[model samples]
Every structure is written in structure tokens, then in C-alpha cells.
Target: MSERKHIKVTYSTLASPDPLLHEYFDESVVEAKAGFGKTFPMYINGEERTASQTFEKRSPVDLDLVMGYFQKGTAEDVNDAVATAKAAFLAWSGRPWQERVAIMRKAADLISERLFHMGAVMSLEIGKNRLEALGDVEETADLIRYNCDAIEQNDNFSRPLLSESDKHHNRSVLKPYGVWAVISPFNFPGALAGGPAGAALVAGNCVVLKPATDTPYTAWLLTECFRDAGVPAGVFNFVTGGGRSVGQTLVDHPDVAGVTFTGSYDVGMHILRTFAQGRYPRPVIAEMGGKNPTIISKKADIDKAAMGVMRSAFGLQGQKCSACSRVYVHNDVKDEFMTKLVDLTSQINVGDPTVKDNWMGPVANMGAYEDYKEFVADLHANGDVVFGGKILEELGNGYFVAPTIVDNLPLDHRLWKQEMFLPIVTVTGYEDMDKAMKMANDVEYGLTAGFFSEDDDEVQWWLDNIEAGVLYVNRSSGATTGAWPGYQSFGGWKGSGSTGKAAGSFYYVQQYMKEQSQTIVG
Candidate 1:
């Protein structure tokens, strides 16, 4: 294999228009539309199987554009997929760690090579800009590489321990779970799903992947990368459909050994409870939602704070689980910070993601669009909508809304406390830093949070007091956003995740395996 290229990848870097990237995206966009009405089949047991029913997937950038027809898999498909994985488990799990690492590394290489095409599909299907879309795919590749690296560095978690006597030898080995169900959400079709899927496969587990209904194209392409990397048939399977039949069946299946899900709090907790009641408890790795907040101290740089807040709040139409949904500023800086935030948000270009110049694109679907409208109405009833409180119907056929900012809502307001998952932010003032900390930590979510403070004491205090799984300090790129795979080891605290262990970190792989102790007496 060739040495991996190190690129300084950041949102700012990807946001800039590169001629090569643009050309590749432009070409792929044309190619993606060729077979619009053709059906996309699910891969089960290494064979392409057509479902009993199929659903249409249209482009969120333009409702007139049809992305493709996707199979609406059912419970029987999930059962068959799981059965295939269960059959393949022993053979896959028996392979040496080095062999598994090599195959996954190859898969990562394929992801890198196909980044442009995948990004274009993401942009068209999920309403992501070129840069945000590209970053998502690139991150997927990096996640696979990181997990493979983890396996090699830890020697596949096979370690020898201190033996009590000379007559005995003691060793600890991390063995693979029988089969894992990977249920991914739409927000991050590539990275989130591919990241966890790679971790499980590298840890020697077979998997049945059920991608979200909204963005199965990117997920299926990802499954192709795994297959082309020479992953044996039945070791990996892809099934697509609604959560009720396909998703529920996969989760509740008796033979499935473990599960990794990335979705909402209600669904995540449901999986947690449902999986626990089975014959015996199984590991349910979940990274749920976040109502992340950003703090601006009086002594902080107001300009930098505003930039960070706006970027994190409006990026991907603020659909991110870690998107900054709330802000707290010192009373002294509230006026200045709000002005800066409004000015920056007002300039964000909202249009088709396929177009190179638009920074903000449409929301994912009508549900999010209607949610934005409902939230905007609620904001007007309870508080002051300082900037951008209307939907942009003029922005063409897709689900489009303006970047919204609000002020003067009481901290107790549901708008202040709930995760809106849209291009909306609510800013409130606080005279006391301690009080602000209390308000920030009051939510049921303890996902990600950021602090913008120049004072060493206050920074330390916020770090100590802030109840977040991922924390950022004064990041202009994104205050409460941007958790890279290897660099950040992103996860959540409290209700944000089932397992507190950060993904792509030192301990992430262990979640996919069970430990066994061996003793040999000669």
C-alpha cells in the first residue's frame, strides 16, 4: 500500500472553491442524473436482491429532480441479512487481525479515491454544499483508517498479563461479537455510518447496515467500497427501508449480538431499553442528539465569537447533532455579539447546493422545513426574532429557510431548551458567568459545548462546569462544531450517547469486542 497523504482538512479549506474539486463535482452531478428512475437494489449475502416494494428518492436541492428509486426492505429482508451475517461470523472473526486491517485499509483507500463522486451524491440527495459534502466523505475515509490504525497499535487487543506462578500462563484476548446492526441517520450519511461500521468490521464482527431513508445513495456507495475491498460475501450487507419494519427488525432480532445507532434521543433510548430485554443484555452503542451551546465572555474577542457561533449554527442548515442551537453571552457583550452574528448570518448565500457560490443550502426535507416555520412562529410569539425569521420560498423548489436568530426568550422556554435541528439559534444574556454555566448545563443533553473566553480562570471554570462530551475553546472555525475522527475522538455525555467512549479514540474498538481470559498450565 502507498503512504497516506496528509491534507490540512478543515471546513474553511473545503469551503474555498478549488477548480479541480469543482470540476469533479460538476461532472459527477451530470453522471448522477443519468439513471433517475432506475431501481437501486439491496445487497444481501453478496447478491443484489430487489425488494417487494420500492420508494422514490428525490433531490432536496430541487424537488423536480429524482435521485433514484430505492428498495423498501422489510422484516424478512432484515432477518435474511442478519442470518447471513450470523453465518459468516465465525469465518470472518477467525481471520487474523493483520488481514482484517489490510482489507479495511483498502476500503479506506477506495473511499478517498471516490470522494468527489460521493460528495456530489450527498450534495444532491441531502442538500449539502460541495465543501460540507466533501468533508463528510473524506472524514469517512479517515475514520476507517483511524480504526485500522487502532487495531494495529493495540495488537488487536491481545495482551499478556502477569501470571501468578511459573506453571501458568495468562493472556487476555478481545473476541468479536457475533453480529452487529449499524443503523445510521441522514445528517451524516458517509462519515457517521462508515466510521462505526469500519470499527466493528476491523474488530472482527459481521454487520448488517440499514441506512436512513433520506440518504441511502451515499450509504450504498459506501457499502460498495467495503465490497470492492474484497470483504467476503455475507460479512457485510446493506438493507434500506423505513424504521418500523426493517430497522426495528434489525434491532430486535434475537441473533444480533450488538448494535450501533446514530439518531434521535427517543429512538436511541428505545434501542437501549429494547436491546436490554432480550435473552441477555447486548451492547448498544448510540450517539444521539445535541442541543450544543456557545458562550461569549465580556473579555473575549466579540468578532471571533460571532464568526464561530454563526458558522456552527447555520452549517448544513444547522441539522447537525452538534450544531450550536443556543448561545449565552455576558450582558456587557450581548448587544455587540448579536449585531455581529446577525450581520454575518444575513450574508450567507442560500441556494442550490450544486451551485458553487451558495454557502447555505435547503433543509433536508419538508419535515425540517415545516419545523423551521413552526419554530419561527413560536419565536415570534415568545421572544424577539432579531434576524432572519422567514422561509425563503423564492429560493426554488426545495425546503429552504433563512438563518434565524432570536433574543429575550426566557431560559425556561422550550425553544431555549429543545433541540430544533434547523438553521436557528437563540441568544440570551447573563450578568453572571456562573449563572450562564448553570443555564448551559440545564438541558437533558450533554453533547458538545464551546467557550469563548480570554480569562484563564473563566476558561478553566467553564471547562470544569460545562457538562458536554466534546468541548471546544475559542475555535473560530466552529465553536461548538467540528469534531474530527482522530484529533477529537467525538462522543457525548448524559443523554447524548449510550456509550461515553469517544468514537475513533483509544477505547472505541473495545466496544465492538468482548474480552476473554486464557490460562495455560504445562
Candidate 2:
């Protein structure tokens, strides 16, 4: 796979993937599955160290299949890692910006070279389809590259701040925050872990990344890329364990500077509140999941909206924070839209993500499987199940479920307003466009919103009035899905995120550092 060397490419809007991707991913998947289960150690102070206890990571595709065993990192491990990062901070932070950019660019290139292998690991680890898995890896590299580009294009963000006079020259420079703890989500492990770490590291901060417990291997590979690029030891660290033991410890650690988290609202808020309690507030950048919505107007193309909505609602099993979960359609076109939606959703093939033919795959683990059952039960009790309300028992022991869609539920129902993060969506019809838009924004979570309207007036109104960080209109690929890094810097509003700034954009890297004013008077 490395010999083939997948050349890096950009994805502005959603487009069909390369045909050769299947051929490459399938062979790598076979080789990856055949290899012996790995044993990963905590990377601390530039060395790989093991803990007394370890935890198993089993494949969601098959319950008995052990993907690997990772060290169960403890508070001591977090402390050691942070101390190492803090110790190395002055040298790493003081390193020339040009050299840092060079190393990061090399890491990005290395990520692109190992795309197929990394994608294979992501497939088994996270249960994303082959195309999606490959795309995730690619996005990771692209995000790093984008940040590197931003650093170079902006002259390392060291511009003059309106020089007062020749004698008193004033300027500003972005400085590292010492040690930035990166807590990434499981849905997009490679990209989320590397994306934030890249931003932090390129901006001259040491990074201690804590990947989601379930997706350690993918993050491990991403770390390998950076390590291979010769990032100084103690500058980058990776630790794996339960959130309570490893994660909370990192959050509460004294020397640690700031945090970048991507997960549920409850946990993100907890981190924010914790960081806010001290004498001086520390920076906390978080992207919590959302109960994202879509509005289909009467003048919209029903076929286009149905196809786009199905892809967004079921892709990655609807696990993305930006995935479309609740959709409101105009009453005049409701019946026709429902028919097309059910047909499109039914056509999705669910099975092992490693398989090229499968479009949808299992939920991440047993917890998500149980959550799916509970969420579907709540939906059935509260609404009319027009399609897909059962689990697929024949699809091995994997946590597989049908792509479910229901209608006629109260727009304000807890299930409708809350973020389920499952392959289930609720639909309702509205007579007025204003009411539909209102229903879309009723939820406290405002991360992503989609609008399907041919009319320019309605599109403009939706774009102007919708309270979301990322907005889509008449998108055939996905209504609320598909936020590329350079294309769209994905972020949230209201309860969805602590930071209003989006990732994979200019402002994101700036968050990893604090600004300092420099003045010289002769």
C-alpha cells in the first residue's frame, strides 16, 4: 500500500470516490485482519512504556475478534506525560516556525503515503465504510496540510501591529500554550486526533493526545506518522485508558495548559466548567455533538432532498455530530419525499465496514448498540414508524441495525430534540416555512443545519436565519453531512460547542496559542 503511495487530493464538495480505492482498501483489510492482535503501550517522554493493567479492544464487526490490547493508563501516566511535555516546551516552542512547518508538512505527506493501511485500521476500529474510512485518513492529512499552509501563508501569524513609530515598533506573535491535551472522538479517530494535534504542534506547543478508548489503533498509526517525521521525544505523547482514569486526570492536571475535546454535550460542558473554576480561566476548545436538522420546502426537489438526507442520516450510522437527525418537510410534498426517502435508505447495505459493497456498517460498540435499542423504542412509542424499526440479527454478532425513519412525532419530543448519534431519524410535515425553520432551531444544540429549497428567497432566509455554525442548501450529496476541513471548518453554536470557531480553518490553529504583544523602543 505504501509503495502505491496514494497521492493526496482535496475534496471541496461531496464527490464519488476513486474506483481504485476499493481495490486498495480490500487487500489492505485482508492483510490487517490476518496480522496478530497488537499490544500498544503508552508513549511517554519519547519512550513506549506499558502499564500493569491493560484493556482489550474488540472489533464491532465480530464480538470475539480482538483488535488489540492497550495499556490502561492511570493518573500517574498522565502526570508523567504532562511533566515531560512541560519540560520540553521551551525548546519546542522556541523552535523556528519555518522548521516546525517543515516537520509538520512531512508528517502530512507521510500520512498520505500510508492512507490505505490507516484506512484499514479505521474500518475495523470505528465501523466506517471503506470509502468513509479512507476519506477520514485523507482528511487527517489534509487538515495538517491546511494548517501548515495557513502558518506559511500568514507568515507564521507574526505581523506588525500598526507600528507606532520607527523608534517604537509594535508587533504581535502567537505563542504556544505549553502543553495542550487533545481528547478526540471515536467517529473520526485519525482526523480528530491528528487534526487538533497538528494545530497545536504546528503552532509550537507540545501535544499529549488521548484518543477514544475504542479507536486507539487508528490514532496509533497517526502518531507513528508524526513520530517518523522526527518530532522530538517528549514533544508528542499518546496514552490509552478509560476516561475516568486517564481523561479526567489529564483535564485536572496542573501543568497541562488547555484542552481540545470532541464528544457529548454533558462531558464537554463538564470540562468547560472545570476549566472555568480556577483563579484564572484556561482555554477549552470543544465540539460537542448536535441534534442537527433539515428543512425541505415545498418548492424543493423532493428526489434530490431525499437522496441527500438518506446519505447524511445513515452514513457512519449517523454517528457524526453534524449528521442530520430531524427533518421537517412541507406538507404539500411530504408524501412524495417520504416515499423517496424510504427507498433510498432501504437500498443501503449494512455489514462489516471492511467489505467494499457495504454502504453502512455496525455501531461502534456494545454501548452504542444498546443506545440504539433504547432510542428506537422511545421513537416507536412516540411516533409512527414508517420504515426500519428492527435490528438485523443475521448480520453476525456485530452491532447492526436497520436505517430507521419515523414520522408524525411532536417536534419538541426529547428524542427529536436530543442527539441520539444513531442511524435513526425523525420526520415531520409543516404547512408554513417559518414554522419549519422554527422547529429546526428549537433544539438547544445548534451545530449543523440543512435547507432544501429551489427558491432563492427561501434559501437566503434559511442561510440568514438558521442558527448553526455550518449550513448547507440544496446539497445533493448530504443535507447536514460532509464538512470538509479546508472546505468547511466544522464547529457549533449554543450548547454544541464551547468555542464558536470551526476546525480545519485559519482561526482553529490560533486557538492552540495565545497572542502576545511585542514592543521595542530604542
Candidate 3:
């Protein structure tokens, strides 16, 4: 192995990665492929426990490829995991905040150390391209570190208040909220799971994580990193199984203190309502899916606008919650922007993502592939497909689809406001900028929005009126995508998220803990 350069690999930083990253990743892929079809156990109370049944995880790139087998955890398993976490909470939370931060920092370091292997596993398990896979793993590590930094800088969230008398002492402190359940989505198994888990654990709360059935291997690797970093036994547990049995069990568990979930809007809403229905209202930090939008002003640079929209709309096959699914461009430059976007979309290579030349990979599973076909058919009936709308049957047996672009879709169409979570974008021309902003903000989701404009006045106007939580202006890297840990705080508003607080921001860590006012007489 050669000495690797210290280059930060975030979504925005993927453009120029160190050459050694590719070499190391390719080597790790070969090593990972040699260990396929192995069965993995669930981590409960620091023990590797297996269930009576197991489920096979096949790679989306090739359905015949059995990546691994994971335990088919049941409601009983969720009960046991929650019990273990609850029992571990006292001793874990009693630890000094500094000590907890130290352990979490070490875990973050371990994640970075094993980045290559983990990245390779994620790419194979989730069908993400090499760069995107690497970015997810790297972001997980950074997200954990950012939380640690937040704790330290805030002095463990302990603040001294003015005293009425010299002998009277008054101060406020934030304390952990017992056991936290983390339900992560398939698209970002590592970051969505490990990031919240790290925050909860670092805040002196124990965590029980339930990963999406589609990508448990990545979550398993993440669990190993925390365990190896000495995150005490039972402090963090991993359970894999169906959402109804395992996920609902974790959510409904009375002993569970809080939850951090990332998935579809409907499911997130269900979790929020269910958690509230418990004995008392417990905290539920949920980031639901988004129907994100991008607006291109007449004053915008056409090339930059097109590039930004193209990357955000098609990256990860547009499975991201922050994907730019709807575009509202000024009628003056709509034709030019459409042409450039179509050309860029046409050039994308769809196939096995592990291959260096392939820029886009298959959808995560059969459901998404089927959904893509249905969406394309609807577009053909109601709108004009300017670029692509076909499934690439030539691309092996995997679920691959072309990056699609639709034009002239009616603003009143349901697709304009729905979260497709696929690589299909709709373009509509707008004559008025205010109306474009109105159309962009009309959706139930307010996750992310992008705008391209050269005029300073237009930029200020966008900053003032955009309803989304994460906003980008004239950025070619990604219009609505590419949010990093410290660079941009990623969260949503309205139906897109239950809590207005964004992850990776200054206020995120405190959400894992409840504040207490402490006072003593001297």
C-alpha cells in the first residue's frame, strides 16, 4: 500500500479524489467478492446472535450475486435489543461527557481507517457508484466527528447562569434521553444509521439501529467499527428484519426513549404518530423523502444550471431525498437549458457501477425498477420525454434504467408534487420568477431547492423566498445534492422532516438529549 494523501471525500469533494482511493477501493472489491454468501449475525448485548431463519441480500448490480445473508430478526429480537440498550443506558450515560466524546472520536477514526473495504461493500450492496459509495462512508465518519466537536465546544451543553446571591449556584445541563432507535433507509445505510447512532451514543444515550432490508451489509460493517472502537457492550445494537416486525417493535417499545428515522414520508409520519401515541410524547427525529426542485432564472448561466440539475437529478439514480426531481426554468432560456441537460443525461453510462467507466448503476431493487417503468409510461401519455424514458435491458440482468428527462409536464400533474425517488426529472417553463418560486414552494416537501442566477439581486431574492431547508445557488457540483457534515447542515421543512433542525448543524446534537436546569445552594 502507498502513502495516501489526506483529501476530504464529501459529496462536493468527489470531483478530485486522490488516485490512491481508486486503487485501494478496487483492491478491496476483489477481497470483498471472495467472501460472498457468508451469513452475518445480529449484535445484541455484545453477543453475535443468529435467528432461526436468515434472509439473503443480493446485489442490485447482479441479482444472481448473493452479497451476504443476514439474520431475520423478529419482534422478540427487537424486544431483547431494546432491553439491552435500556439496561446499558445508565452506566453509559453516567460516563463523563469527555470520555464519551473520546470513544466516539475513536470510532470515527476506525470508520476512516476501514473506508476502502466499507466503501466497496456499500457499492456492491446498494449499487452506488464508487465515488458515491466512498462519499457516504466518509460522510458518516465526518458526521460523527462533527457531533463530537459540537459537544466539546458547547462544554457538554452546560451553561452557567447569573446567580441571585454569591452562595447560590445555577446552571443548565443537557442529559441523554435513554435508549434511541435509529431506523435508516436503504439509499444511505451507513451515514443515516451511524450518524444518528453516533450522536445518540456521544450524548450519553444508547442506540438500537434497524437498517433497511435492502442494505444490511453496509450497516453491519458500520456496527463493527463502533464495536471495535470500544463502544461498550449493549450501548449500540444492530437488528435486521422486516419493518413491520422489527422496526415497529423498536418504535413501539415503551422503554425506548427516542428515535431517529430516515425513509419515505408515509413511513416517517407513521413512526412520528406512533411514537407520540406512547405513554408520553417522546422525541422523534425523522427526515422524510422529498420532491425537491430547482429553478433556473433567465439571468442564470445555462451551462452551470444544466450541469447542476443533471448531477442532482440523476445521481444515485435519483433515489436521494434531496434529488432535484422538478425544474422550473425561465421560458427565455428553457430551450437552451433543456438541450444541455439532455446531452449530459444522454452521455451517462448505465451498468454495473463497480466498473470504472460506468457512471450510473441500477436502481436499488425491483420495486424501484418497476416504479421507473410505470413513471415513464405515465410521462409518455401526459408529457414529452426529451432525453430518455426506456429501461436498458441490454445492461445485464440487473435493474438498470436510463437517466430520464421529461418536458411540458403540466404543473397541475401529480408527478410534479410527488416524490418518485427515481432518475426521472420533469421540466416546466415559467414566464414569471415569482410564480416559479411559488411553484417550487407549493409541494408538501421542503427538503432542498437549487437556483441558478448570475444577478446578485436574483440570488438575494432566492435566498429570501426559497422554502426548502437546504439551498444552493449557481453551483455546478450539484443543484440540491452534495450536502456535507460541517459545510452544509442537511435537514428539511414541512412534510419533508418532522423536526426543523438539520443534521450536521450546531443544533442537531442537543436534540438527542434533554436539557435540565441544575441549581445548588452553597
Candidate 4:
């Protein structure tokens, strides 16, 4: 019971020497059949707290309890965490700009060191593949380093104007919003948490972060990275709990100046309403869900287009908000493309993520798996399943949904309109460009959209007309570059984003800080 399960860190060609990439194991993984179950301590106010109740953590791939932790957070715990963040904010906000830069660079280095380890943990805990997990970690570290450099490079030092009789000179600097908090979701847990944590820390604000209940380990490891980087003990904090209490506590805390969140649209709206009615309403940046669309042009390359659509619709089991849910193919190429798409999708291997060749893994949990099953069933009852529309029954233990493609579904079909976060892809053929554009813009949720075309004019037209925040041309919707942390200045228009961007552009950070200009006569 007192033994730690350790795994050596494996690095890809992209890994750096920072210890932040080191793998962590259960120093003492104990399983219980009944009673209070097992538990892992919570990180609060720079110390680990062992409470009375246990919070069980499970692996998505298998219904096994990977690790469990104590639900040590109470109202008092919240206050302590917030107060520590507030106390640290005083000195952090007043520190020299260069000092902040150095600290942030150190943090980035630490994260780089632990990139591979963090990636593996994310893969094991959340069921993301090795490549996807590594990509998230690499992008996170790069984003932090980039932001640190940008802030220093910008060096917004105001210069005094020349005058015959000058009364005063002034220098303006960006200041912190004191105590900030981040409540992140399970999908992209490490990247989501790291984006806000690194950004807020570099901006000289103290943070208390609450990771998703299902994926808090990534956040805990990230907290270790901050600690290893020599971030002030009270500067960064982590806590895990149910959404209702922990989320509301973070949002409504008087000492908490700002909140960065990413989750569903409904919950995001609830937070907005709650904050509006509260005494201390701070800035909240939330990246909600989306029903993204993908467009295929008549003259597009059929093979490439089909492959792109397949990956976008099936990769990561389509849990991503940016996943291509709706695909609009030109009528001229619809028949050929659909056939090829079905063939390509049918060939995808749906199994465990550990398998090097397994193209698709199981859904995150039983609820998600059930939802996907119900969605496919509904689609089958209402329309037709062109290629794959059923779950692999032989695949036991894990929540495995077959890579499915549905055709002949009307625009008003539930499958077409819904954000089916599963391996379900719906196709609609368009005769004209105008009609295609209308179909793509039909949905209320606009997070991302993809387009495949050789014509420059058509690409530009879709780019100009698409309602999504992020649009792609001649590429699958899954192509997210390292430069984009998915939370930066870009956020969806309608239901996807609130209060500007999430990170890497200072919009959310800028919201926390107050701005004022001074004028004087000499």
C-alpha cells in the first residue's frame, strides 16, 4: 500500500530537457472494495491536505480506479486558497517586469522538461492517444514561452514628451488583477489548464486552479511544474471537486479577481448569470461547446477531401468541439467522395489507444458512450447509416464506438443539428455555393468550420462568409497548429466564447487589468 508505481519518461523527437516532462506514479496506490474507497490528497495553499472523504479518479479506457483523492476542500479550504493567491498577488503584481519574464521562462522550461511525462499521464487518464497528448503538451509549453517573450519584447514603457515647461512625466505598466482562478474541463485538460495558469502567472497574477474532476492529475502535475520553477509557494494553487460547489466557489469568491473557464455552453451561461447576480462579479472567459461544419467544393480533390473529413469527424472519437460534425459536399462530387469516405472510415481501427496502429480509441466514459450509442440509434431510425452506424460489441470493457458516417440526412435531422460528440459524421450535398454557405451557417453554434477547395476565390468566399471563429480551407478540421493554443484571441462568435479570447493575446488578461489615460497642461 505504501509503494509508488513509477514509469520511465519516454521522449519523442520533439521533447526538451525540462523536468516538467517527467512521468509521475502512485507513490502508494491503494484500492478498496468498499467503505470510504481510496484517496489522493488535494493541493491547497502550497500544501497537501488529507481530508475525511475520498474522491475517486477513474481511467476512461477502462472503468478502473486509476487513483483516488481526498475531497479535502470545504468553504474554509476555498478561503485559504483564495487568500494565499491574494497575498501572493500583492508582491507578484508589484515585481519588476523583467523579473516576471525570468520567472515565466523558468516555468516554460520546467513544463518542457515534463512534456513527455505529462503527455503520457494525459493519455492514460483521459484516453487521448500519444500523438495528441504530446501535441497538447508541446503546444502548451511553446505558448507559455511565446507569451513570456512577447510581453518582454513589447516592453510597453511610456516615454516623456518634449516640452518647454513640463509639469510631470509618466510611465504606465500592465498590472495584475490580484487573485485569478481557472476552472478547466476534462478534454485537453493539460493544455487548457496550462494556458490560463502560465498566462496569468506571467502577467503577475496569482492563480487558484480547479481541474476537471475526471482529469485533475494533469493539473496537479502542472502545479508541480510551477513549484519546481520556484514560483512563490502561494502564487499557484490546485483543487479538485464537483462542478456545482467548486466551480461556483471559484466564480463567486470575493478575493478572486478573474476566472478562466472552458466547458459546455449551458454551464458557461449559468456561470454568467450567477456572476451577474453576485456581489463581486469578476471577468469570466469561457470556451463553450460548438457544432462545427466542414465544406467540400465541387472542384476539390476527392481523395484528400474524404480523408480530411474522415479524420475531422472520427479523430479522438469526435469529442473535440472543433470536430467536423457537419460536412457539406458539392453535388457533383458527393457520390464519389461519399464512397471513398465510407471506405476510408471503415478501415479505421477502433481499439485501445495504447495500440500504435489503433486509429480511434474509446469514448471518455460510460455516459459519453451511452450518449453516442443513443445518437447513432436515433440517426439510424430517422435516416440511413451509409457506412458505420453501430458500436463494436466485441470490444469489451472500454467505451468503443465504431467510426460512423451517415448520409441522406436532412438539415433538420437531429443528427445534423445536434453536437454529437461521437464518431458520427453527417453529410449533406450542396448544388450551389450560396446554398452550401447557407447550410454551413445554419447552426447556432459556430466554433470551427472546414473547407476543401482548389479555387482561391471560393476559399476566400467561404472564409469571408463562414460564421465560425476558426475556419480552414483545403485542410481537415483537426489541423490545429502549435502557434494556436485554441484558447488564444480566437473564440467562437455565438455560443462558443464569452469575454474575448482565452490566452496568448492578452484579451482575457487585459479584462482583469484596468486601463486609464492621463492628460496634463504644462
lDDT values of the candidates? Answer: 0.90, 0.88, 0.93, 0.71
Alpha carbon lDDT at 394, candidate 2: 98
Q: Write the per-residue lDDT of candidate 2 for residues 463-504, one digit (tens) a residue.
A: 889999999998878889888877887899999888889987
lDDT of 4: 0.71
Better TM-score candidate (2, 3):
3
> Which clashing pairs does model 3 show?
none
lDDT tens digits by residue: candidate 1, 1-522 = 334233334455655555566767777777777756678899999999988789999888889988888999989999999999999999999998899999999999898888777888999889998889988988999899998998898888889989989988999999999899999999999998999899999999999999999998999899899999999999999999999889999888999999999999999999999999899989999998999989889989898899999999999999999999999999999999998999999899999987888988899998988889999999999999999889999988888899999999877799877889999999999898888888899998989999998899989988989999999988888988887877887899999988889985788989999999999987
**TM per model?**
0.97, 0.98, 0.99, 0.88
Q: What's the TM for model 3?
A: 0.99
Clashes of each: 0, 0, 0, 12
Worst 10 residues of 4 by lDDT: 24-33
Best-fitting candidate, measured by TM-score? 3
Check candidate 1 and list the clashing pairs. Answer: none
For model 2, the superposed segments whose C-alpha errors exceed 4 Å read 5-15
- Global lDDT for candidate 1? 0.90
- Candidate 3, which ten residues in sequence have the lowest lDDT sum? 1-10
- Which is better, 2 or 3, measured by lDDT? 3
Report the Cα lDDT for candidate 3: 0.93
